[model samples]
Each structure stands twice: as C-alpha cells, then as structure tokens.
Target: MKHPKDPSAPGTMRVLDKQPTLQRRSFLRGGGLGAIGITVIPVASLAASKDVAARQSFRHLGAATGRTLVRMARDIYPHDKLADTFYVEAVAPYDAASAKDKGVKKLLADGVKDLDQRARQRCGVPYAEVKTEDERVALLKDIEATPFFKKVQGDLVTGLYNNKKLWPLFGYEGSAWEKGGYVNRGFDDIDWL
Candidate 1:
C-alpha cells in the first residue's frame, strides 16, 4: 500500500528498504544486534536502552502523562493541537511511570471520559474522533465556561498548565513570580510605545 505521505512508494514503508544487499544481509546476519547483545546482559537490557534513547530525544511535559492530556488539549486548543508532536516525546516517560503516579493518573481517570462525552454531545464527535479545527475549539470554550464543564476543565487545565512542556507550546515566555522565569525569558525589554 502507498504511504499517506509518499504516494509514489508502492510497498509498505521499511527503513531497510533503502539499503542495498550488503547492509541488509549484514542486518539479517545480526551484525549490529549480535555485537550489542554481547555487551548488553539481558533482553530487557535492550528495552532499557531503547527507553533511555527515547527519553533523550525530547522533553515532553503535557504528553508525559499520556493521551488524557492529548485528548483534553485537543478539546481546549483544537486549532493549536501540539499533542501529536508532544506525544512523540512523551511515550517513554509516560510508560516509565509507576501506578503510584497518583496525580497524573487521577487527572486522566477523572477527566477523560467526561470530556470525551461532552465533546461528542456538543460537536457530534468523540474527543478523540473530532476532525475539524473550528468545531474542536468551539467545544473547548464551551467546556471551559459552562457550569457543567467547570470541574473537569479545571482539573485538566491545571494538569496541563503544570506540565513543563506546555509553556513552549503556548508561547508562554515565563512568569514574573517564583524563580524569575520572567527574567530567563527576557520579559523586561518591552516598551509599549
């Protein structure tokens, strides 16, 4: 089947497809994996290596908790959906968390289902299912201002606002309070002429 991004390609996308016989044959012979396996102790060690590699690649605040934030953020700021990018960074960190991460887990458990239902009711699509930008944003504002939406919105936004990665996504240039985030972002230069 053709890749959505590259219609010209006819077969299934394969990273190895670009390589010639020697590299592919060596890979099949377990060239790299065999060497690494000798150095790495157990099969789980390889998994741990992958986990570390994933964490090193990006810093994800909102997505570190999982798809709950993605769903909520999509609901709230539909047009500026950064969740897809954030999710790429978050997968490892999110999977690393234990069951004891009560704060994030509760936030997801409490808000996701209701938020999804509200999104479906207001827009005729589930939170995860919505396709259009305008419909998503309108539903988000509705969820934020309505009394019925108050509790869940508060919880979800609180979690999102607290995420370390959210600031970059929102263009938050830091704050004047606590540890001088404002100074770090150089908020002192504005002259309102």
Candidate 2:
C-alpha cells in the first residue's frame, strides 16, 4: 500500500488558507504565555491611541534596538515627569529615516549595536537593561562625538521637544509668538517682574 500525495505544500498559502497574520492583536492575546517581553517596552507617541502592552514595532530597527533608543532618548532629555512613550516617539524618526535610506539604516543599525555592545562590556546586560543612570550616561558620552550621536541629538531636540502634547511637562506654553509674543502674556501676569 502507498500513501497519497498532498494537494498543497505545508505552510504555503492556498486559495482558502486560514492562516491569520501574526501582526494582528488576536495572536498576542491568544497566546497564553502571559506577557511576551523582557522589560516593559515603550509604546509609540501614540500612547493615547492603543493598548500599550501589545508593543510598538519598527520597520528598520529591531525590538531591542527600539528599546535602547527609548532609553537613549530619555537619558538625553532627562524628563522624569514624562513617560517612556515620549522617548519612543522621539527615537521613532531614526527608524523612519532608516526605512528611507540604506545608508541611514546601516549607520543607525551599527551605531545602536555598538552602543549595546558598550553597555554589555560595562555590565552583563544590554543597553536598555542597564540599571545605573550614571553608567548609561557615561556609555552615551563615549559616542557623543560620532555622527550617529550628533544626528540623534539634533533630531531629538525637535522630535522630543516640539511635541505639543508634551509641552506642558517642560513648562512651555505652546509658542507665545503665535499668541502675539510672551511679553504681553505670561510676563504680564507676573505683576512684580
């Protein structure tokens, strides 16, 4: 007796294939592994838009790199009042740039890998998992002279600070020039100035 041949190959798509995309929320929820992560991953600036625990992804950067960038952005800005979501948003532009340019992709990818490597050398864990603030800051300072660090600094200045939703954290009252300048607004309210 002989076995019959299969109609379609395993894992290949057929006209009526029932496979659902892993990107869908149903996949994560269906899995009973509890939380599928190492540390609490940062959500994108769209913090107000979705379930943050589901995780934020990047087209150019890996999950670990995204997490590292979140830490780097926070270290640079040092905004204890703000959440990691804002730092995630600030670092998101690097991923977008990498998606657009292969050179940028290589630069950022290599830069982040190096940064992570430095962290591992200092401690035993990756950059995002490093416990001490001074250690992380010192690690960043090592790369402060590189183009990658400069690009991150320049982009983050706008990406982190220019966010209207985050302005209140920095005490910026949303561009006083648009409201006829600050001299007549906040300053005027300070009577004894």
lDDT of each: 0.44, 0.68
**Mind giving the per-residue lDDT tens digits that candidate 2 earns over 46-120?**
455342212668767777777877877666656444566666777877778888899988878888899989989
Candidate 1: tens digits of C-alpha lDDT, residues 39-79 = 11345533444423223432232332344445443343232
Candidate 1 colliding pairs, count: 0
The window of 10 residues in a row where model 2 has the poorest summed lDDT is: 29-38
Point out the worst 10-residue segment of candidate 1 by lDDT. Answer: 30-39
Would you give me the overall lDDT of model 1? 0.44
Report the number of clashing residue pairs per model: 0, 0
Model 2, position 190, has a per-residue lDDT of 61
Prediction 1 TM-score vs. true: 0.35
